[model samples]
Target: MTTPTVAVGALGGTIASTSSSADGSEVVPTLTAELLVAAVPGLDEVAAVRAETLARLPSPSLDEPTILRTLQWAQAAVDEGATGVVVTQGTDTLEEAAYLLDLFWDRPEPLVVTGAMRSPAAAGADGPANLLTAVRCAAAEGSRERGVLVAFDDEVHQARWVAKTDSMSTSAFRSPVFGPIGRCVEAEVVYGVPADRIPPLKLLPGHAGGDPRVPLLATYLGDDGFIVDSIRADDVDGLVVAGFGAGHVSASMAEAIGRLARQVPVVFASRTGSGPTGRAMYGYPGSEIDLVARGAVGAGWLSPVKARLLLWALSLGGPVPRADVAAAFELRGRP
Candidate 1:
């Protein structure tokens, strides 16, 4: 059989970074996609690889337009007969980037996103191993139709559920609600639990119009909703609230949320690291039930960032109906 072709695109991160100072102190992304691919051992035996440097910015500097460009690149790669695709970027924003790609990646071939927690200058840097496993996962037959995946530490997680849970660990990325859906063992891919695949959002013509302003706010103790009240409905296209446990917030914030929901879409998600937002458990003034009654939608399992992305994507085609936004949350927010 012909070797499967995998296209690797580099969006510079720790995986492609090295020490920029003579003292070996500060590290910066300096390697190209071809250089990263060349460092991997036994990668040639797995698949025929095509490498390209899409961008050289740190993950934090990566914006929505860059991600959309990468998405288009991946689609074009698939059209060019590449069996799969691997995206290398900084781990800092890997989860968010992967999810953003997942939202519009309407393809059967796997698009795996991977990044290194440690820079190439660090002891035992993990870029090569992570990239190899990501390629293996991308080449795996089972990975098809699985949507965009975050491959890290030999584990494969669905983009919708994965998040960066730690700041300085090789195992920082995790699918908190459910563990990884698959793992690469001995250069072979093994899938454990099956993940539900949500249909990719359709991008209408001129979908790249203006950047939508959707801010994410987290509730805390004694929060008086001053920040929420300060945001004018005319300024923002949508809002996402990372509410207290099970999607509850201060009574004052809930009132402000209700008022804002009347003007624009408001999505509430759990602030806790794991678990879905409560739908109807509590009935208090600031409970999920109360928020729903006030027109805010519950982001069942989506994190605040992901919820914000969804709201932003929805509003890109102009003002989305509140019911339509709620329906989107109901579908994509579920596990």
Candidate 2:
């Protein structure tokens, strides 16, 4: 008969934005966690809630340091005996932020993230609905051990597979490979599919000082090797090439990638967003087979954003062996 404690942390986004004046003026993040939770009708019916405002900036303004700090805050909430935690931020980087948290959230309690596509002042604001559903999902016993979740538009998506597929509309987030694992209907959370658990990467708290900068390059038609050549002269520690189709670049890029692979770690991901990068599908110049033979690690099912984060994390632990880098993806990059 007792409700579990659910901690809700608010990082300012459209969910918290409001017009400064009654005459419909400039809108900004002006709502606090307490205000947000107060707007959610029947939220108290699900769980005992605790609210806190961690930041009041758009999600795009958030950097790695801010994200790392927020992660620490979430951990502290978990340590304080919160059964589950919900975070509200901008939808622009919700998928990426959730994925980053998944890599570090080594806990069984659900960490549900949600945000509104429309501002609170807009017609038919979704913030209240999303916040309420996020709390319900977080309080559910079935949501535990499912990794970080992005709950929006009544659907719950796993962090690793979810992406922002649309610019507008409430149905913006989607998992191209794996669909929603759960949905919130009439304040009840129903899980439709079982989610696989991925081992969290080993990243110590407050130890994100010197993560290596890894640049991602998306290949295009008639693309010369100028960018790669330019990056080769820079101080970047790693590169993730988002190749066309199933990972194919122009022949000129292949030659540059071949040369760069010898100097630094090169990860090949698909610019198409989702799908496995081909390993031996083609043997022609600039083919996936050719790139793999030239030591470009195929990023199997990992998006370019996630691939970049993984490579950066690996590089932060000092010079990792090439084989170890390949094994990291092989072991943890599944969709």
Candidate 3:
């Protein structure tokens, strides 16, 4: 019933960038806690706002420990009476990071992640505006109902559905099939279709001291098992086959997946990135139908990176129980 206080946590990305002091030749990211606060003067008008500079790394440089620490800090902030938490991160791997947090987050408090497409070098860099709206969304009562989210381009997206669609556009973030779940309205938030809100971030580091490589191979119309077999014989730790629509694969490709499953685990994700994979979704001989029956895990509506990250964490050998890993997809009826 009390007024909510929102906290913004800054991780390095384009949001925290600046031009070179002397030459102005390069726009390097130099976003510190102080500078982020300086960029958003409206924080004083909203609920108690505190900005903490947790990391100064690029988005592509984001790793499990950093994400874990960010989740921990956000959880602590909400526990300290803040209504929610906002994270400013690099856009490179934001989708993957957000999905990781969504599956593992264990609380009900609002958690919004956002970033900018252009660095400080660009004229209309969208960092400050995005950060301000992320804070407002995190504090909005409607936001708490959606779990971990990404607030960008004036739109609120579920961490699960958001993917970067472009490199140079401010509209890089998008949810292709389902569209945005919410958006910012002045100082408030508005909801669209209700997102599958999950528990707060309760993640255990599944990739600590483990290999982070997730080689993805997609099967084409005339594809053979050549590429798949190569990855199996290489230094890769896991495999994510982006099968054709409905998760269908070629007979040779399905055989390759089965072979890789024997050496290391192989998971199948769809190139469509929407529906869950169905081994026999298309009745084709090489359809993912055979892959699932061969002990390969099927990613339900999760894109390749999310599937790869989940598999990477699983391969570390000390992750949550096997049944628990299997349970991660139980919501989609994984057998």
Candidate 4:
């Protein structure tokens, strides 16, 4: 029997959107799977589209349970011989969940998460079009080998490389160092398989939102780092410092991070959130080069949460190779 194509849904972000046009100002989108599917055309022919309304929360409001629930639903789809999975979520924290799902799923099926900037009632609205394209990508046989992907604004990006740049631009999602896997046209989807870390993505026990154990602290000039003191005094298990560009923490923060790393893992991530976190990329008060030399683990492209997740996994004894996790955020050619 031929491997049939099917879809699994995890309602998020724009996919569950509603228009504010009727009420005048302050029209927040009220999203529903039924409404979103009706908006997209040609999805029926592509695969067996199924919807799971896991949450109606905004992307930034997405929590750990959101990640786990969506993953669970997708895993069931794959087990039942579904060829692909599509997730519709808000753009704000899309990468965070995408990276998390990519790490959690060991299955060899495509997981594509797509969301939109414009809502259904607005002119130049793009949600329906993006959703249709995502379904097509999920249905495409070629997508299976690519591991986890996030298809947005017609561009197919590998999960690990994509970042949401614009607040509300059609050209929002971009993979700076690497371009998209390919673009989805009306007729077809095209892309070559990339060299991604195969299954056995060491399982990492996730942390809930507002966990007093891990504090993500930022460092700036003349920064008192009272938060750091608070975190230390209260027994934070891990700390992620958004150091200066290129991953440098404040001098005082650096010293504090160094001490903290000895006690708990101190992950260095860039506030830039788009580039690799490494030394020698810039000259500043707290350059990453110094941090790495100080035994601080540099989170190459990982945003703070991603870096935290990876560390939490490693600390919990997940076998996801350190080098693989390192490669997740490192510069393209460097990886």
For residue 218, model 3's alpha carbon misses the true position, in angstroms, by 3.6
RMSD to the true structure for each prediction, in A, is: 1.1, 1.7, 3.3, 3.8
- Model 1 scores a C-alpha lDDT of 0.92
Candidate 1: list runs displaced more than 4 Å.
Answer: 194-196
For each candidate in turn, the TM-score is 0.98, 0.95, 0.86, 0.84
Candidate 2 residue spans exceeding 4 A from truth? 21-26
For model 2, residues 38-57, the per-residue Cα lDDT tens digits are 99889888889999999999
Taking all chains together, the TM-score of candidate 3 against the true structure is: 0.86
lDDT of 4 at 167: 90
Off by over 4 Å in 4: 1-4, 20-25, 192-195, 198-200, 204-212, 279-285, 315-334
Which scores better on TM-score, 3 or 4?
A: 3
Local accuracy by lDDT, each model = 0.92, 0.86, 0.75, 0.69
What's the TM for model 4? 0.84
Model 4: per-residue lDDT, tens digit, 215-295?
677777776555665566236556788766767766777666666555565678877766667757654445676666555
* lDDT, candidate 3, 1-335, per-residue tens: 56668888888888787776565546666878667767776876666777788988888888876787787788898889888888888899999888777766777778889988877556787887888788888777777667789999889988877899888889899986778988787767789776465443334555333455667777789887888887743576667888888777888888877877766667778887566677455555576667766667778777777777676655555433435545665553231
Give the C-alpha miss distance for residue 193 in model 2, angstroms. Answer: 2.5
Q: Identify the candidate with maximal lDDT.
A: 1
Candidate 1: tens digits of C-alpha lDDT, residues 1-335 = 98999999999999999886876668888899999999998999999999999998888999887888899899999999999999999988889899989999899999999999988777889999999999999898899999999999989999999999999999999999688999899889999966458889986667744478899999999988899999999999999999998899989999999999999999999989888889868999999999999999999989988998999888888788899999999999987
Candidate 2 has its poorest 10 consecutive residues by lDDT at: 202-211
